[model samples]
Structure formats: C-alpha cells, structure tokens
Target: MSKQSASKSNIPLNPLAFIRKYDELWRRMLFLIGALIVYRLGSHIPVPGMNPERLAQFFDGSQNTFLGMFNMFSGGALERMSIMALGIMPYISASIVVQMMSTVVPSLEALKKEGETGRRTLNKYTRQGTLALAFVQAVGMSAGLISGGLTLTSGLGFYIPAVTSLVAGAMFLMWLGEQITERGIGNGISMLIFASIVSSAPGMITQAFTDNLNLIVILLFAVLGLAVTAAIVYIERAQRRVPVNYAQKQQEGRKVYAQQQSHLPLKLNMAGVIPAIFASSLLLLPATMGQWAGTSANPTTLQSIAQNISLVLQPGSPLYLLLFAVFIIFFCYFYTALMFNPSEVAENLKRSGAYIPGIRPGQQTKRYLDFVLNRLTFIGAIYMTIICLMPMVIQTSFGVSFQLGGASLLIMVVVLMDFIAQVQAHLMTHQYHDQTLIKSSK
Candidate 1:
C-alpha cells in the first residue's frame, strides 16, 4: 500500500546481500573465524617435557575409552598433550557446579534475582572455579604423564612447568571464549566446541573409510549421516506454541485498542546440548579415575573400587548406556526447570493482562505450563538419549567406527542451527534499519 512498505517488501532476503551491506556483521563473522583459528593453533602446541612418541603411543592404545572422547572435544589437543590439553572442560564443569548450587544456595539465588550485576558476580565465581579445576586436573594429568613414562623428564621441576602451562592455557581459552561471545557471532563456548568437533571430522572420516574400505558400508554411513542431520534439524526447529490473548487497554487519548493475540514458543529441547554434555562429563569422571588407577603398580581399596567402576562403565557397556540415559533425562528436566520458570512466566503474563485460553491467569497457568514442559522434556530426553546412544549401538551392531555420532553430532547440528539463526537475525535487523532510513529519507 504505502511506498515505504512496498520498498521494504522488495528488499532481498539473501544472506550474502546482508553480509555485503552490513559491515559490522561481516566484521563479527571475521572475528569469530579468527578466534577459532587461534583456538586451533593452541590445540597443536604441545606442552613441554613430554616425549612425543610415548604420548602418541599412549593415546593410540587408549583411543576407545574416555580419553578418546576428551580428545574429540579438544580437537585432538588431549592426544597431542597440547598446551590446551585441558580445553574448555574446566569452565564447563565449573558452570555446571555454579548452576547446580544456584538451586540450593540462598545467597546465590538472591544474587540470581539481582539480574545482570548478579550474573557478573556469578561469572566471576565460575572463572575462579574454572581456574581451581584447571589446576587440579593439570596436576593429575602431569602426574599421569610422568607415571606412564610419557614424559621425558620427571620430578617437581617438570611437573610444575607442565601444570602451569595447562592451567594457563585453559584460562586463556576461557578468556578467548568470553571475548568471542562479546565481539563475535553465535555463542562463543558452543562455537568453540563446534569448531573442535568439526576440525576432527576429516581425519575421522578418512580413518573410518580406510578401516572399512567397503563401498557399500561407506554409502550406508553417508546415508545415515544425512538422515541423522535431517532429523536433528527438524527437531531443533520444532516448538510448541502456547496462545495468549492480551486484554484491551485505553491509551492517554482515550482510544481503546483491540485485544491482541500472540503465542509463546516453547522449544522441544529447551536445555539444548547442555544435559548431554553434563551427563558425559559426569560419566567420564569415574572412567578417568579408573584409567589412572590401572596405571598404579600396587592398587589400594579405593583404586580397586574405581577400577571396577570404570570396567562396568565402558562406552558400550549396558550399565554405561543405562546410567547415561538416566543422567540425560535427569538433567533435561533439571536444566529445563532452571531455564524456564513456569511461575515467573505466568506472573509476567498475568501482569501484562494476558491469559492462556481456558486457563486462569496465575496459578492455573503455571500448572498448565509445568505440565506442558514436563511432557515436552520427557520427549526431549528420549530423543537425546536415542541420539546419543545411536553411535554406540551402531558400533556394537555394525562394527563400524563412526566417531562423529551421538553427542558430537548433536552439538554440531544444534550449534550450526543456532549460528545460522544468529546470522539471519543480524540480517533481518540490518534490513529493518535500512527500511527505517529509507522511510525517513522519503
């Protein structure tokens, strides 16, 4: 109808066009790329004092266990015993601890209610926690390297330097992730993890192909990969829309506006890849401890217990699968609850004079929302469980070495979707700004 609206409607929706027009968006994208390059480079810089041949031999032997998975997440940094061997796990673990504490700790809960300032305080605590964790893990890793004969030099002299290097590297990575979040595109931590997984892809694929060398098997895996990717994209986009009607109100000029209808979009997987990551990290702890115990010449009672626990929890073990699914389901509900508070949402809706159809404004709305969320979480948990277990199942059944399955696949797919969504959002915002400028000029 109007010239402004007509011109706006004619604007191209193409991503390339937006990138060409918006210098800031392109700059952010470049920054993200540069940050990822730095991370990759760090992943290749091995820590000093380790014998490269012995380290490589150790990882080669341990490739099927928890260490392998850690290596995958670190973009081969663990196998290389890189300066970044610790990767971002310490930060993730620290975040999990902080978030879990927020539920039970009154002070933290109060801080949470304080908003941005509180968030900053909590983040400071998380970084401190990360540093602490990095120190402990670095000590363990350095000691392990010495005990396993992977280190060319031994004693406190070697240990001290190695530990310091790992801890410093981890802290640097944490800082890099934060900077990317502030100055680049997409979520920085997730993007880093995504980059790690993707960096390992070419090698994994080549190894798998070499091991199998069956054209049929290769084709089958290719088809399955495509299918899984499609499934992930479809489910990630799926959401349940809860309709709400806002009551009409009179303005300063005494003009009454008509009631407005809108919908709240609740995603199927509100927790995203967090639950899976949490579950995997928890599962890895016992296995890692067990691996360390196995290296001991004389084992104590505690070490024996740890070894038994690790044996029972190998990746393809029945017990491992069961516990993994349970943890995933538990975290799905736990994290979803933390992220989306039904009571808060209901309160906000009520304050805005909005109501879900056939539901009362406050308590009833909360109850209904909780019910919907629980059901959705249940389905999401099942979906995540299946996706995560598929790799193990395929390995056990088909004897295929499909390393890039399950949690890695989910992270890659989800992060990619989020990245694309962020890019599109920037493009749309730029287009809107351009339309406004055009209207003003007219």
Candidate 2:
C-alpha cells in the first residue's frame, strides 16, 4: 500500500485516544462548561427590591403570552425576576440591528468588508449597542414592576438600584458569552441559549404532568417530539452540493498534478435557528407592550391599544401565525443573504483556480449560486415556519402544558449537533497532526 493509505489506516478511531493526546481540547471543553455553569447560577440570583410573591403572580398571569416565551428563553429568569432576567436577548437584538444596519449604512457596510479589523470595530459597536439596549430595557422593566406593585418600595431609590442591577447583569452575561466564544467550544451565545432551554426541561415536564394532561396525550406529545427531532436532524444535514473542477497545475520544482474535483456544500437551512429566534423576539414586542399597558390600574388610550394588540397577537391567533410566518421567511432570506455572499464565494473559487462544471468562473457562477441559494432558502423558510408554528397549534388543540415546543426543540437539537461537530473537528485535527508528525519523523 502507498504511504497515504498507511497513514490513513493508522488514524485513531477511538475517542479515548484523541482525549489522551489532546489536553488542550479537554481544557477548552471544561472552560465552556464552567462558563455555562456560571450563567445558570446567575439565572437564579434575584434582582434587588422585588417582591417575589407579586412578581410570581405577574408572571403567572402573563405565562401564556410572549412574556412566557421570553421567560423560557431566559431559563425562567424573567419569571423569578432574577439578576439575569434580561438574559442575552439585548445582545441578540443589538446584533440583529447592527447586521441590518450594515447592509443599509455605507460606513458599516465598508467596515464589514475590512476583514478582522472591521469585524472588531463592528463587535465594539455591537457591545455598545447591547449596553444601551440593556439599560433601556432594564428601565422599562423596573417601571413595569413598580407599576404592577411588584416592587418592594414605590420610590426613585428602588427604581435606580433595580435598573442598575438588571443592566449590570445583562452586561456581565454578555461578557461571559464573549469569553466563552474566545476561550471555549462552539458559539457562546447560542450555547447559552441552548443551555437555558435544556435546563428548564425538567421543570416544564413536571409542570405538564401536574397540569393533569392525559397520559395518552402526554405519550402522543413525546412521540411527536421524537418525530420532530428526527426530522430536524435530517433537514439540518441536508445540503445541495455544487460541483467544482480545479484545473491541473504545476509548481516550478514539482511534477504537474491532475485536475481535482470538489463540491461546495450549501446547507438547506443556511440561517439555522436564528431566523426563528429573531422572529420570536419581534413578535414578542407587541405582546410586551400590551402586558405593560393593560396591567395599569386605570384604563387609558394606550391600554386600549395594547388590549387590542394583545387580542390579535395571541399565540394561536391567525394574525399572529401569519405575521410569525412572514417574519421567519424574511429573516431566513435576510440572514442567509448576510452570511453567504455568492459573489464573494465565486471570487474566492475563481482565485483558487476552481470553476463550477458547465458554468463560467466569475459573475455567471455567482448568479447561478444565488439562484440555487434563493430556492433552497425559500424551502428552508417554509420548513422553519412549520416547525416553529406546530407547537402553538398542538398547545391550542390539545390544551397540553408541554414545554418542549418547536423553537426550544430546534435550538436544543441544532446546538447539540453543532457541539458534536466541533468536537469531531478538533479530534480530526489532532489525528491529522499526529499523522503529520509520524510522517515527518520517518
């Protein structure tokens, strides 16, 4: 056999071997776990000056609304009015705004093209935006609590301290997420969100059981959950492979090489779970406003407006579902466009002496890629809409209190897949390194 075949055969198949050889990977994994633990612990630390009973009552009333959804994402932090009540949402909101702005604002767009330096600048802006948004949200939350008589004191002193605590909590969580990204495995923000969802699972399940849901209904939901999970795994793995052929080339000191063939694999759902999250956040806005307005003691024009919106945008409402579907589709395409630039991919392929079979090397290839991506994205959007909306339909129809809904399930499954992929990548790199060293020593 050839040396290549021998080296390939020698690659370690046991995970234990990779672990024994790569201490750094283990350290990174540990660091990620530690960071997530810190986040989970912080989620239980209540903010100062809140009356727990009243706060719990408020959350109970809003439990079926968008606030409940927000609370779920925060791992019940909002329900407890915890220090991490804001969660990582403000950061996500800021990111969405900055990404959208980068498209419309010339300076931001230019910065997007500036590579690492531009990326750093954009990150700085996003951090600043996060702080500002957190502060504003904290203030609003404090005011809402005070208005709802959920605060211990009714004075300026209470507002000042409570808002500060909440804002600081959010900023700290943001810092933790950044640290995780820099020092650990996978996407930190996504991992934190994933952790939140998973951590809340037991409580949600227990709640479902206590709600007196029929055993058969519960069993059915479990079956549906498994089915949805299987579907998600299949869809997430689906990709459209575009064939490329690299022309033969020769180095001045080496023999000419034969033409190489490769394929660019574009995921069916390029946006992943992001569009669903963005859409949920957007839909929750009106619901939040409605909650705050309708909860006031006296009825006002704003309260009436909020009530009307609340009625129209309830979870299972036709209008709510329609708007949700629209937002998901918009963000799926918008985020896909932001993340994968066909022109840039085409340029890189051209520079690397690669061309798609039966297509020209540059603009034509870009157009073709765009066409394919658009079609795939449309299908993906439909898939996401169905997956996300299915839970609401189930809850409405079955009156079941099951919490493992589509968005939660999607986030959990996708993040787990991503985590496994990262570990596999690290293991592969370690194996390759080992193989290279063996070859060099020989």
Candidate 3:
C-alpha cells in the first residue's frame, strides 16, 4: 500500500511518464503547443502602414493605462501594433453579451434547452457578434493611429487596409481558439490567454531586473506571488458538499435497489475568473474612448468629459480600484445566479427520490440550497476581490511595476489548474476503458 501510494503521488510530479504511456494525451498536448506557437508567431507580425517603433513607444508610456492591460492580453501584440493586436477579446465580449441575452431573450432561452444543436446556433451568433465588434474596434484603432500620428499614410489608403488586417487577425484567432477547443487538451480561448501571459513573463522578469530592484524587494514580490498562487489553489479546490440520501426503490421484476448516499458539491467560486475579465473589459470601453479623445487637437465637450472620466479611472487609481471591486462583486453574483438554479436542482433531486438529510424535498431544499449558495458566493466575492487587488496594492507600496497584475495572475493560475484537471479526467477515462477491455477478455 505504501509503495502504491508513493507511485501515485509521483505521477503528478512527473507528467512525462503519463505522456509516454498515453498516446492520445501526448498528441493532444502537442497540438495545443503547436497552436500556441502559431499564436505567438502571429503576435510579431505588425500591421501595414504602422510605425512599429512609435507604437512601442506609445505602449511604453501607456503601461499604467487600459492599453497596457490590453497589450498583456494580446501577448504583447498591441505593443508592436501586430496583426493580432485585437487578440480574441472581441469573441470574449461577444460571448458575454450572448450569455446575458440568452437569459432575457425568449428565443435564445428556448435554444439554451435544445442541447448540442442549440449550443451550435449560439456559437454561430457569437461568431457574428465577434465579427461586428472586431470591425468596429479595428476602425477605432485605425482612427487612433491617424490621430496619434502613428500611421505612415494619411488618407483612406491606410485606414481601409489596416481595419481589414485587424479584423482578419481577430477572426483568425477566434477560429484558432475554436480549433484548439475541439482538437486540443484544454479550453482553446483560455489556453490562448494562458500562453499569452506565460510568453510575456520572461520579459517582465527581465524588466524588473533592469529597473535595479533590490534583491529584498524582488524576494518579497516572489514570496507574495507564491502565496497568492497557493491561496488560489486551495480556495479553488474548496467546496461545500451537501449530503444527500436516495431512498430504496423496487422495479417491476421484484428487483430492489439499495439506498444510496451522495453529495451535491457547491464550489466556493462558481464564477471563476470571469468576473474580473468582464469587469476589466467593460471598464476598457470608456478608457479606449478617452484614449482616442485625448489625442485630438481640438476635442469636443463630450470628448473632454471622456478624457476626465478616463483620468479618474486610470488603472491603480483609487476610483478605478473601487469601481473594479464593485464590478467584480456584482458580476460574481450575476454570473453565479446565471449558471446555477437552486429551484432546478431541487426539482431534479426530488424527481430522483434524493433528499438532503433533515430537509424536506422540493421548495424547502431549494431555499436551503439558495441560502448556502448565497453565503458561499458572498465569501467568494470577497476572496476574489482581495486576490485581484493584492498585486496592485503591492505595486503601489513598493513603487515597482510588476508586469503581472492580479487579474492576470488569477487567470493564469485558474487556467492551469483547469488544464491539469482535464488531463487527469482524460487519464481516468483511458484507464476505465482499459479496465473494461481486460474484463471483457477475462
């Protein structure tokens, strides 16, 4: 037993053993790596008629603004004005909008119940929305370039082609992400974002060193990072398992099934990193407008108001942080409510003859579940708020510019945990298949 336990413990530490044993796992992993490589390669290809040096300079000064966050999501593509500067944000935004609408729109709500076919239809709609968003954003970026004097050509010659390139790049990424989801190991869009964050880490570290940060400060930052990562893992794995009991039942042939015990597991963080991402994306809208408005030689009154709004909401500012927290908390409850329905769970449990101990089935069970979930969500909102704000606090205190923000770190850690979980699931499926084969042979 001791030897078996030791071997099992070592499995995760050395994934190479599993890679060698599982052909499908390795092939999927290889495909994922190749797709990310393709994404990184595209990040280096600058758009036509844009000044790369000027673009880099602009981003360098704008690192404290929303543009910096945008660049980070693009794997530094925006810094170079690369073809993929828009990244897959348009798709993400479209997805969020579609999901919100699905709850309110009767047609979409009905489609949500149609299973796989419905999912395909919604994905088509998301793609169309992505296309529209990408075009609008690309046009904005082009106009910003012209206003900021970052473009080589003045007229429609540069505008049309630049917008086309940006839109195409975004669409390509959206397609690539979908392919990865179907053919690769993890969720394609998340994996792409993970790759982007990781690819940019070395540069961030190098920049820290070049900034003459003392060893002690660097050590402190490293310690904080490790602490945050550990906390994330712990909280992510935490769940409240509600005990359930199934009553014995008899079939027509006098066959009786024994009573069964089970659990309904409620995650501490039902929303994951989505709240942070959504809040950031929403906030970027005003900031992007301000960025363009500020560049104009003679700004209109509304533009000036936008510029003022942008100033108040610049990343790391008190107002920005407050709004960020509010949005994160709001979306946490909103998304959790969207994804989980206590009434449905209660109904399903009642139908299956399962009931929580000491609690009546149906409405009572739903109310209990709702109470539990609300408390869990409240705790989760606070936890996420801290995790997403800690890095900014550290940066402000130390006066050090750490390229990794709280949101970025949370996304990276959560995505990696999810990837590992998927791998483990695949492994279990393969093992189950092998065992079935052995049983059949015997």
Candidate 4:
C-alpha cells in the first residue's frame, strides 16, 4: 500500500468510540423527529363543532398579517379551533405569570430558593396554571363559535361537547409537548412551534409559485431570510465577558494555591426570544377583545379612541408595527432586569474573593455591572426592535403578503443550529481519541 494509505489504515477503527460518537450525533435527532410527528398528528385532530367550510372561507379572504401569521405559527390548529389551537401560548403565559407571581408572592418566593425541590413545585404550579388557562380559553372559544353561529350551522350538537373537546384537545397537545421534551432532541415546546412554522412553508411556496410571484421578489425573500437567520445566530451567540481577578493565594497543605482569573459571560440577549413573545401575547389582548365584540374590534368607547385602537391593532398597519417595536423594547429591558441582578453578582464576587480591576469591593462593583448591563441592553433592545420590525416593514413596502415568513424562518434556523451545535460538540469530544490515533500513525 502507498505510505499515506498505510498510515490511514493504521488508524484505529474502534467500535466503542464509533458507537459513542454515533449515538451522540443521532440520538437527539431521533427524539426530535419522533416528537414532531406526534405534534403534527395532534394538529389535525379537529375540535368538535368547528365548521370546516366557514373556517376555510374566513381564512381565504383574511389579511393574514401579524395576528393571523402568529396563528399560523401555531399550525392550522388555531384556525380549526382545535384543542391544541391554544397551542403553547397558554403554557408560556402561565409560566410568565407564575414567575412574576413568584416575586410578589412570598410563599412562591421561598419555594424558588429550594433548588431542585422548589423547581418541581414551580413546574407543578405551571402545569396547573396551563390547564386552567386552557379550560377558560376553550370555553371562550366555544362560546364565540356558537354565538357566531359557526357551530350550529354544522348541526352536530355544538355547545357542551365542543367546549369539552377543545379543552381536552389542548391538554393533549400540552402532554405531547412535554413528552417530546422528555424524549426528544430539541426543546419539546420549541419543536411544537417549529412544526407549525414548517407546516406553513410548503403552502407558502406553492402560493408564491402558482401566483406567478416575481422571481426577483421570491429571490429577495430567500436571501433576506438567509441573512436574518445568520444574524440571529450571530446575536444569539454574542456575549460580553467581564474579567474577574481572584485574590492571590499561597500553598495550603500539600497543594499549591493560585489565583483563578476568569470572566463572567453575560449574554447580549440574556432573555432570548422570551421578551418578544411576552410582548406579542400582551398585544393580542386588544384583538381578542375586538374579536369578542365588534363594530370596531376595540371596546366601545369615544368614536376617536375606538377608531384609533382599531387602526393600531389592524395587522400590518403602521400603528401595529409601532406598538410592536415599543413593546419589544420595553419587554427586553423589563425581562433583562428580572434575569440579572448587579447586587447579587457583586455579593457573589465578594464571597468568592474576586473583584473587577480598578473597582471597589461591593457597591462600586454593583454600579459597574449595572452600567455595563445598561449599555449592553441598549444595543440588544435596538437590535431586537430592528429584527422584529424589519420583516413587517419589508412586506408592507413590497405589497407582499407572504414574505414575513422570513422571521419565522430565522427563528427556526437559529434553534436548529443550536441543536446541531450541541450534537457536534458531543461528537467532537467523543472522537478525540480516534483523531489522536490517526495523528500518531502519521
């Protein structure tokens, strides 16, 4: 054999190493795929008393803008008024509420400090809140459907059974999401959302092609989406590291003691997509009110006020985008405040005998942290605002109804990259010995 080929052959083909790497590479993926299948199955199980024909016609002429697009992110389940129609929104809402409540509610606050045991307690409460919210939402939807005459039109005996079915269906989806998280690769909740985004993709593609959309326009959409996805990946991984100098130490017993110099990695966007989500959910309240009763979607008020709110809440309206950007910015700061505490950090540093250079021990360190955090947050909030609003502005300017799928695509790409990165990390570490073997043979 040639020298190079002989060297390659001498490298170990170790079964144990190969199996470990292979398992690391594929196990999570297997879980994710399996969970996604279950989520899709749940999406199609229709809520009782939903009029398929009416639902179809409503969607056919609808604006399909902000709120409608959000619904699509939950899959057609929202339109179908299926049980999972509520999707993960309620769970997310309950989680936010519980977390917020934990701060205000002393009992809950105590539980939060209990570590693993406290976490389990919080999880239990979150689940309870999810179920309660689902039941209420399902009832509201049931009443809305029946009052709108959508249920009775199908003549299938609507009211009581429909509410029951819808609630049960939503709960089923919740269970499915939890199962996926337990046994899947990606976050189970995120996978459910991801499934919704993907389910809508093929339809959008078909619509674009069959409608004879401008090729340049379609290409622009693709390129913009790719760019946004790349940007999201970059921003998600971005962090500001603050250096810490530990107090120098001498030998103790048989071991040499040395200073540990390190830095804290504070993520640029510590709150992740959570703030955007919370803001969006809160904004939907007005639309839900309008849907509940309407001459205008807003509550009956002074003519100008009602008109103004209706205009603002309208999908793709300038007012809606404005409100969305403001809300995202607000929530970004709010969530950031909730997530990080300068005082706590300073206290930890004091306990650990570490200090930032040129900073005093306690209050000064806290002040410095707050100053740095505020600056980072300013940049982060602006970045978030631009990302959230850019797609809306583009679609509106171009008169393109379907382009904002780019935002959803961006989220999916980032999330998928995170999952892939975790897998690759496991594989690389597991294959280190194999690489060493190959190197030595050379």
Candidate 5:
C-alpha cells in the first residue's frame, strides 16, 4: 500500500499537467466567459422610454414579432429601449457599404492594396460612416416618436430629448463593442449576438414546452439540433489539402533536387457564415418595409402590400424560399470574389518556388484553383442555405414560429464555434511549451 501510494504520488497530481501534458484551454475559456458576461448584462439594461408597468402590457398585448426578435439579438435592450437597443447594427451596415464601395470606387480600390496605413484610413472612414448612420437612424426614430411610435406628453420638447438620448445610447453601445474587440477573446460584435441568442434560449425552450409539443417532437428537435450542430462542426473542419512541392537548393556546384511538401488547404466552408449574413442583411430592406407597412399604412392597403412583400421576400415564404436560395448562392460567390484572388495566389506561389503536383505554375495553376474553389463553394452554399432556411421554412409552414435568424443566431453559432477552435489552438501551443519545459527540468 505504501509503495502504491508512492507510485501514485509520482504519477503527477496537477490535472493541468495531464492536459497541459498538451493544452491549456482554461485561460481562453475564462476570457470568453468574462467577455460574454459583460455583453449579457448590457442586453437587459433598459432604455429611456421603458414604462415599467406598460412594458409588460405592450409585449403581452402583442406577439414579440420580428423586432422583438431583433431585441432578442440585442439581448432585450431593444425592449427596454436601452442605449444599446440599436446595438451594433449601424456598424455592420457601415461595413457592408464600405466593403461594397471599396470594390467599386477606384480610389478606394487603390487604397486597399496599400497595406496597414490604408487599412487604418479605411477604418477611420468606417467609424465615420457608423456615426453618420447612427445619427440618421436616431433622427428617423425621433421622427417616428413624433409621428406616434411614442406619445409625447411635452410635444416638440420630446424630439430633442428623444433623439439625443437614442443617439447617445447608440454611440455608447458602439464604444462597448469596440472595447470588447480590444479586450475580449472572440469578435466583440459577434459575441454580443451570441449573448443575445444565449439569453433568449431558455424562453424559447419554455415557450416550446408550454406550446405542448409532443414529448417525441420536443426530443426530436433537441436531437436534431445536436446533430445539425455536430454536422456544422465537421464540415467547418473539413479541408482539402492540396500538396505542394519545392525544389532543392544547389550549393558549391553540387545540385540536389530536394522535395518539400506543403498543402494549399481549402476549407469546405471557406466563405463561412458571412454569405448568409450578407444575404440576410440585404433581405432586411424588404422586411423592414413590411414592418413599416404594418405600423403606418392604411389597414387594407397595408395588408396587401405586406402580403406582397411577404410573398416575394419574407423568410420561408415561397418566393422568399426561392430568392433566399439564390441570394445565398450569389453572395457565396460574391464574397468569395471580394476576399480571395486565385490569380494573386498563384503568382505568390510561383514566386515562392511552390508548385502543386501535376499542375503548371502561374495562370494555369490559378485556373485549376479557381475550378476547385467553385465546386467547394457550391457545396458550401447549398449546406448553408439548407441549414439556415430549413428551420424557419418548416416552422412557418406548420404555423409554428421559432427564432431562426440568419445573421443573429446561425452566424453567432458558427462564429462561436470558430472562436472556440482558435482558443483551443492557442491553448494547445501554451501546453506544448509547458510540457517541453517540464521535460527539460526532469
């Protein structure tokens, strides 16, 4: 027993040793958790017009509609009408506009290739754009208040106060997101969306339960969700490793053809959830009009217009299903084009003395890479479109509503998954260092 105890003691007691016997995931987990907490807290904080008693009545009197869903993505701040109610949406809008402009505006296109300084300049412009958009939307909301989104007991006095408060809140929220990006683990804006989704999960589950879904159906979706998540994980990790060969160097008049190996790894879903996000953001214009039509137009005319919009553009509606599919496909290609250039890649590879096996270098190699990417992108587009659109379409078809958002929920999930993998990679490297030091000490 004494011998056994001694052996056990010698086996190493620090569990971190066993895990750091390769990777330390705890530190990264801690940072991610801490950042998420800050975002979640902000979501519940209320805005200026939050009439305590009336707030519940307002939500109870009406279904939490799409804006309610938007509020959910904002972590309930929208309902409370908090400073963060506008969330970081204005920034996302600004980014989209800037990204599109960078491709079209000749001067902006030149600036893109100028490296870090140009990037910094673009960043400044993006910030300017964010502020501009926030201000405009703030005024719009203020006007909406005057037009009756809110009741002004003080008449014209309300406009100045409301707009000021709202705009200030938006800028504050923007600051918060920037802080998270600087100090937090995952992308700050993405983590905000993650917090919102997580905050709302319990309510959604309880609602489903109370709706009296059959035990089997409840269990089925639960299992299905798990399965789908696992599939996403697998697909995201899948990579096509194209082998590259490098010729050997000659020294002192002796030539040795040395073969080196590297892989041009192409991810199965390379464009990522960005395609879905872009598509969803574009679709929101029509959807926003539908919302406005609901609130402002004459009842009958509103009904017809809303129906028409829904038919053509609403998520899960028939025309919506068609357009959504096409949009996913289009943006998959479009964003891929924006971010990557096979010709540039081939040029760089040739300069570096790397060549794919059985492939000619330069433009020919570029063409081959392009061909491969097209097929991979098609698979990715199909997978994304199906996973994202299915839940909403099926639910809408069955007269059951669920919160299935392309930009908010699905994108958050995918981004979070990627973030976790990156964290784990860092942890693994740290553990490897610790292990090497330990071995040297022993």
Candidate 6:
C-alpha cells in the first residue's frame, strides 16, 4: 500500500480526539450546551397571575395522568405554570399537520417539488399553524387555571395575560430551536426535547428516594433502561444491503473498464423516532384539551365530549395502547413512503446503468424495492411499538412510577446516537482534508 493509504488507515476514529483537535466541533458543542441552559432557565420563569401553591398542589394530584407525562416533557414547566408550560408540542403538532397536508394537497405538493423556496413557504405555514394552535391551547389552559383556582384573579384580566404569555413563550421556543438547528449539532427540536427529558432527572431521582424504592429495585430499573437502550442501538444500526452491479463501458479504442459493484443500505427503521414522536404529539393534544375541560366548573357540550374522550384514553387504558400502536404503525409506513420513492430510485438507477442483482432496471426494480420497504417498515413499526409500550406496561403491572418512560428513553437514545454519528462525520471530513494537505505538501 502507498504511504498515503497507510497514514490514512493509521488516523484515529475517536470523536473526542477530533473534538480536542478541532475548534469548530468544540465551538458547536459549547453553543448547544449554552442554548440548552437558556431553555432550562426559561422554564423557571412563571407566568403572571399564577398561584404557585395551588398549581403545585394541582400537579401533585396529577402525577399519574396525561398531565404528568406532559409535565415531564416541559421539564416541570407545566407543574409550575411557567411561561413555557406549553413547551414545543404546539409546533410539533403544526408541523405534522403541514407535512401530512403537503403530501395530499395539490398546491402544497407543487411547492414541495419547488425545493428550498417551497421549504420556506411550508415553514411559514407551519409557524402560522403553531400560532393558531398555541392560542387555542392557551385559552383552554387559562380556563383550567381559573376553574382549578390556580390563578390570582378571574375573567379577562387573567385570561388576556395568560394566553398572551403562553403563546409568546411557545413562539420563542420555536425560534430558539431554529437557532440551534442552524448553529449547533444534531436536530434542534429533538435536542430541545432531549434536554427537557434530561433536566427532569434530578427530580425523578428524588421522587424515587421519597417513595423508598429499594436498592434491588433501583438496580433492576437501571438494568431495564440499559437493556432497552442497547436494543435501540442494535436495531437502529441494522440495515438491509441490496447488491447492485454497474455495467462495464469502453473508455477508448479497445480499453474496457471493469464492472463496478455497490450495495444500497436500507435501514431497518427508516422513519427513526419521527413516527413515535408524531403519534405521541397527535395523541396528547386531545388529552390536554380534555384535561382542561374536566377541570371546568361548568362544561359545554363540546368540552363534555372532550372530557369523555380523555377519560376513555387515560394513560394506561387498553384503547390508548391500541391506538398508540396503530398510529405508530401507520406513521412508520406513511413517513417511509414520504421519504423514499421506489419509482424515483428505480429511474435513477436505470439512468446510471445500475441494476440490483436478479432484478430488472425499471418497473420490476420499483416493485422489488417497494416489497422490501413495506416488510422493513412493518418490522420497524412493531419494534418501535413494543419499545414505546414497555414503560406503560411496567408501571401498570408493578405499580412502579417509571417517570422516564419508554418513549422518552427511546428518543433520548436515538438523538444521542445521531449526534455522535454527526460528530464522527465531521471528524471524517477533517481527516480527509488533512490527508489532502499532506499529499499536496509531499
């Protein structure tokens, strides 16, 4: 082998090493850490007119319901009735709606094909949707606060400020997430969610101690978390490789180049945590409105229907679990379909003179790709469903308060894995630049 190849092989693969060597990577890491700190700090700033004592009491009684899970997502902001109590869910819900619509709506689909300009247009629509949803949710939450006597005053005096604060807070967080995506590592929204989940760790630990959980049980829970995380790492890394062969071509007079071979790596879980995240956000929105209605002193017919729906879908209900699984499965297929087009892939491959082993280049290849993707998506959906349901099942069966549920755990693991992968990619690029510099000097 050449000296260049030998030196390239000798380069270290450790991300930490590159982090120490490269200023840019460390700068991005620091920026991410600083942004998350800002988010945590904002969670402590309560909304005006909130009765802190009553709010605390209210959330204390709601430790096992949908409120509890929602509170966890907000990093205790909801429990405190803070300015950021709404968290990022409004934005997520709006995004889901916009994306799903884009798939079916002719005008939206046209914009989607228009590329970057279309992306900005779609994003503008999503922001508008976020504002609308946030306003409606804020109004409901304000009513609940008044009904529960968690507010300092009644009527429009409290209502106006509360709604304004909540909506503004949600928009601010949306902007912060955008900044993080532009300037930091990993996805901005996922990182924010991850930060929220992790920020609650100290409180969860205190709760465990207060409950007098035994060392053995604590160890068991730790083991369980590790096992789940390990499983996610394994499955997230798994891929199906489809072998492809490129046809040989004549370069000049009598010189024919050798045929080339490569493989397309189709992930076992192409949708990743998106399906679960989307399903959770969609499921929780109704429950939030229902919880607000249930707190009302006098509910209207619409509120009554919402409350009944909430009651039926209360955290551990069989219907909740079944619907969660079904939505996850649907989104797994839906998101996968949105991201990958077998016809497009087949067309590209045919143009490039590449064909999958034993498969024709055009329509047959598309069919084969579709068959493989459907099977993969089916397995992925089932795997995500089982992993997401583990915490609920454990809590219901053993009467244990597993505050860090399976869904949150799965998201954290997946986000961290993706972050690390991005870091490694950065390091690889740096290595390539260094190799080029070395060769140019030689």
Model 2 Cα displacement at 423 (Å)? 0.9
| Overall lDDT per candidate, in order of appearance | 0.86, 0.87, 0.87, 0.72, 0.68, 0.88
Q: Write the per-residue lDDT of candidate 4 for residues 1-442, one digit (tens) a residue.
A: 5897675655457565456657744766777777677777877788766778877665565435333665666777776666677777777778878988988999998998898999889989988998898777766656556545555343346656776776676677677778766665656676677788788777767776777778998898778877887788888889999999999766666675778889989988877776666766666645643453333223345534534564568666877778888887887787888789899899999998999999998999999999999988888888878877787778777777663443466457656876687667766776786787677666
On TM-score, who's better, 2 or 5?
2
* Weakest 10 consecutive residues of candidate 2 by summed lDDT: 9-18
Question: What is the C-alpha local distance difference test score of candidate 1?
Answer: 0.86
Which ten-residue region of model 3 has the weakest summed lDDT?
433-442
Better of 4 and 6 by TM-score: 6
Instruction: Compose the digit string of candidate 6's lDDT tens values, residues 360-408.
Output: 9999999999999999999999999999998778767766664677888
Candidate 5 residues 1-442, lDDT tens each? 4775554554444675566543335654565677667666755665454345544555543333545555566666766666666677777777788888999999898889999988877878888888898787666544433333443243556656656766676666666666666665667667666677777777777877787777877786777677677777788788888788886767678866677888988887888877776666566544543553444334466546764674455455677667778888887887887777899999999998899989999988999999998998889888888877776665675555456443344676687886877777776777676666555445
Query: Which one wins on lDDT?
Result: 6
Query: Model 2: per-residue lDDT, tens digit, 327-387?
Result: 9999999999998999999999999999999999999999999999999999999999888
The candidate, 1 or 6, that scores higher on lDDT is: 6
Candidate 6: list runs displaced more than 4 Å: 1-21, 214-216, 297-302
**Higher-scoring candidate on lDDT, 3 or 5:** 3
The predictions' CA RMSDs to the true structure, in order, are 3.7, 3.9, 5.3, 5.3, 5.4, 4.0
Off by over 4 Å in 3: 1-21, 252-255
lDDT of 3 by residue, 1-442 (tens): 4776666656544578545558888788899999999999999998899976777677778876777777778899988888899898899889989998999999999999899999999999999999999999898878878878888886799987899999999999999999999989888988888888888888888988998999999998899999999999999999999999999999989999999999999999999888988887787766875786666677778768877887888778899889999999999998999889999999999999999999999999999999999999999999999999989878877777655878889999999999999999988987886565445444
Among residues 3 or more apart in sequence or in different chains, the pairs in candidate 4 whose N, CA or C atoms overlap within 3 Å are 83-170, 290-297
- Candidate numbers, best TM-score first, in rank order: 6, 1, 2, 3, 4, 5
Ranking by lDDT: 6, 3, 2, 1, 4, 5
